[model samples]
Target: MNLCELLQATDGVLLQGDARVSVQGLCYDSRAVTPGSLFVCLPGLHTDGHHYAAQAVAAGAVGLVCERPILGLPAELPVVQVTHSRRALAQLAIRLYDAPARRMTMIGITGTKGKTTTAHLIASVLRAAGHKVGVIGTNGVCWPGYRQPLDHTTPESSDLQRLLRQMADAGCDACVMEVSSLGLKMDRVTGILYDIGVFTNLSPDHIGPGEHASFAEYRAWKSVLFRRCRVGIVNADDPQTEAILTQHTCRVVTYGIDHPADWRADADLTLLRQSDFLGVQFTVTGPDGQARSYRLPMPGRFSVYNALATLAAAQVLDLSVAAAQTGLQKAAVEGRVEPVPLQAPFTVVLDYAHNEAAAENLLTSLRAYHPNQLWVVFGCGGGRSRVRRFGMGEACARLADFCIVTEDNSRGEPLPQILADIRTGMQRGNPRTPFVEIPDRRQALYYALDHAGPGDIVAVIGKGHETTLQRGNETLPFCERDILQKYMKARSS
Candidate 1:
């Protein structure tokens, strides 16, 4: 592709210097620059990409996409200036990938929770209905008849475009991606015009100095999905759903469990496997259509919403009720409310609940099942808000019968200080819940497993499906699920 053509797809930004520069590749990082490559200058949280502009040029960056005004450069090197680098990067990447997102039917799910589970259910149903569906979310990227390890929930703009192109080339007709607040705010999904956008729900998250400055900004970023989409599917029951939907210029579809809605939940919602591990069975009703029942392999109220949205999304995608039911029955997410295999007559769960809201939800659900005791093991990220850390500890102290404070990715922060902040939160609570602090995550797991009774339930939180634990600059190899499984098996034997 020529530099002239790429700039045309962008906001008509002037393409200075040679318009005939045949771009061979694209890069956002200066280290990856190569001959005839289009180097994008993105302003990051800690690093300004503009400083590396000369380095990119020195490394043979023939084309430059920058937000700042271009000054000194080879008179022949093509430079395009845009108001925003991230958006421009997405547009350019899409063009470079030949607009693969436009070629395929794309679905995006956003909100603070249930996005991963909803995406999983949708991908499963699509595959069962004999459609090639590609999935990109917290559980990792996969397509029908394919599975691939993913490092980021929402990858870099270039990686996103590259992956979409790969899926399209592999004959995938549709793709479902988890749209994060950060991803939308940063322009990761900029060029991809979504066919369907689903909002699961929202809560206080990613709100701090480096992330969203406030709740308003966070909500604003989630709204971007609805705007970018042509058809919006939202959980109408959520308190903020109307706000998100109103911002949409596209068509809207709503799903709920309480009443006869566009995608409604029928009567007789039961918690399947409630006595042992949790699961749910519910009937879905579409307007002027026969209701279909689904049996989810997972539990909780959120799972109900996840399946409801899946049914509606599947209906829109031309799938039968039977197909959606079958898919929901077998769909399982990796780290979101996952059940770890254990031989003990107790329940052991692995989840990515690292905050007060998620932890409260998980522990409260378990309490409803009347477990002998609920043990929660969680820790705060080193560089995140201390308010959240304290809040999560308070929630756990108020809810869980037993609490084990453990290390969770204390990158560049002192372990003792982080634990102290969590203790400060717990101190303000009932002050009766016993908490044993173990900086070693593995040691914490051993203590929790060794102490819990047969009827007790243990929840290992923070680092759900992730395989690494960060301590300052070092990322120790760790998988909470895998570690729990090994300990459980050893304890049983």
Candidate 2:
């Protein structure tokens, strides 16, 4: 592609140099600049990308896309100035990738919770329907033979476009991704039109400095997806659904258990627990009034909502109910009520319930299983709102039979302070609740497992699908599954 051709995709003004300069690639990070790469200077919170323009040029960046003028760069080097570099990056990426998102059926799921699970469910159904599907969400970007971890639930524009191109090239018929509020606000999904947009549910989350300014803003960002998509599939049971759809342009399709919707699950939902398998069975009546029973290998009423959302999407895509049944029965998301196989009589589950609402939902749902004792082992991440720590603590204390407080990503913050905040919330929630504080997460897990009684369900949460533990400035390799397997093996030996 040429600089002139790429500029046609954006309203960037060519400041200097030849517009005919060849652009082989595009990059936002200076450190990743290569020969013939077009470096896009994005303004960030910590540091301005404009400062690295010279470095990017030195590393063989053929042209520069920046928000401001550069003083000391080759006069002949191409420079395109844009009002918003982030949006420009997205535009350039789409052009460079030949708009791969348009080549496949794009389904985007958004909300405070259930986005990841719903995305995986939709992908599973698409796969069962004999379509090559690709999924991007909290777990990462994955298809049939490829899987990669991501730094954010929704990646930046350049990487996202590149990934979509890869998926399209690999013959994927559809692509489902988790769309984060921040990703929408940051214009990461710019220039990509979604075939179907899904709103699982919304709650107060990511509300703090450097995130959403307020809950209202967060909800507003979530609503933006409805405008960019052709068909909006939403949760009718959520009270905020109307508010989230304010100013929306797409036609709405809904699914829920409590309210009447295009897709409605029956009230007689069953919770199934047999040996190591935990699942839910429910019958849903769609818009056509045909009732069909579906079984998902995931428990809780929330899982039912996720299924409803999936079914609604499947119907919108004109897929068969048989495909939905096959997919739901086998679809499983990692770190989401994920069951660990153990020889012991007690059950151990790993979940990513790091917030108040999530913790409450998980513990309450597990209680229906009639565990002799429901235990939760969790910790709050550092450098985040103390409100989250307090809420999580309070929820666990109020819901669980026992609470084991431990360390989570204490990113440069003192572990003692985080633990103290949690203790305060625990005291407020239920002072009489038996609780113990273990600063070490691994030690906390061991303590819970070592003391587990027969028929007890222990939930180790907070660091769900993450493979690394962040402490201070160091990110250590940590896999909870590996640790649990090692402990089980050692105990058996």
Candidate 3:
């Protein structure tokens, strides 16, 4: 494509360049620069890209995309300036890759919790409707025969474009992606325009120096999805919903269970359980003549919200009510309320509930099933908020019959110290019922399941679909499902 054409697609102003300048490739890192390559300068948490402009220039970068003012300039090197470097990179990558998002329907789901679940549900929803769908999120990107575990919620600009291009090549009709706050803030999703954007819910999370600076900043970054999409589908019951939606330029659609929302649910929100499985069942109705009954394998009232948001989002894409209904009913999300069959005695589930709110919610839902004894196996991540330990521990004590505390991604932090923090909260919530600290997660799960009676429920929390456990400089192989199934299979043998 011509240099002028590229700038037009990127919403970038060419400070100086010939329209006929041939483009070979695009890159952000200075090291990736070569002759005919355009280097995009993005400001990072640790360093400024403007500082590296000289290096990129020296590496034979013919063109540059930047938000910063050029310091020392050569007359021949062409530059394009934009309001934001990340957004510009996304747009440029999209144009360079031939606008793949426009050729395919795209769906984005954002929230503090339920993002992975919502994305999974939407992908299944689309596939059930006879569409070839691709999904990118917690379980990595998945298609029919090809599956690759993605390292980021949203990948780098070039990588994202490549994935979209591949999906387009593979004849996929739709793509569903999890839109993390980090992704939005960093402009990881710059180029693709979404057909529909779904907001599951929001809370105070991912807030720190390297992440969002404050709750207000987190909300602002999340708002970018609505601003960029054609339709903004949101949870009406969320306190942050109105504020998030009010600033969006796109058409708005809402779903909820708390109030009589546009897409509303029935009065009964029940958590149902059999010997080996537990889930939430509810009926939904909407002003747009929408009605369906769904029994999600996932638990908690949040599951209800996740489903409704998905349905409303499907509705925005002009899908039939029946198709959306079927999509959600058969939707399967890995790690979020993931099931593990145990014939030995009790029901066991593996979930990535690593936060206070999610832990409380999951435990509360399990409690509703009336298990003879609810056994929670949980732990905290290292280098995070130590305050969360108390909250998560207390939540399990209040809801679970007992808990087996263990390690979750303990990198450079002592497991004993982390266990001590959790014990502070557990002991404070209820000093009764046995609680043990077994630093190793696999062993802790064993202790819980081995002690469980026929009617007991064992929930292994944290490290859901993740295959590798981050332990200091080493990455340990850890698959919760594999560990759990092996143990259950041994008893059978």
Models 1 onward score TM values of: 0.95, 0.99, 0.89
Query: Per-residue lDDT for 356 in model 3?
Result: 77
**Which residue runs does candidate 2 get wrong by more than 4 Å?**
none
For the record, the alpha-carbon RMSD of candidate 3 to the native fold, in angstroms, is: 3.1
- The residue-by-residue lDDT of candidate 1 on 330-426, one tens digit each, is 7878887788767777778888888888888878776766778889988999988988899888999999988899889998999899999889888
Q: Give the deviation of candidate 2 from the true structure as CA RMSD.
A: 1.0
Q: Between the candidate structures 1 and 3, which one is better when assessed by TM-score?
A: 1
Report every candidate's CA lDDT: 0.84, 0.92, 0.82
Model 3: lDDT of residue 271: 76
Q: List where candidate 1 sits over 4 angstroms from the true fold.
A: 12-16, 70-72, 144-151, 266-268, 274-276
Candidate 3, 1-493: lDDT as tens digits: 6677788876677776555677777888887788778788888878877778889889987778889669676767788888988888888788888878888899988888888988888877777778898888878988777799997888877778878888888999899999888998787887667888998888877777688778999998998899889888888888999878767988888888777578888768877777666777888997666466777777778788888888887777767777876777677777877778767667888889888788877887777777798899999988777877888888888778888898888888887888898988887778785788887788987787678888787888888888888776678999988888898789678
Q: How many backbone clashes does candidate 2 have?
A: 0
lDDT accuracy of residue 376 in candidate 3: 90
Error at 199, model 1, angstroms: 0.7
Q: How would the candidate models be sorted by TM-score, starting from the highest? A: 2, 1, 3
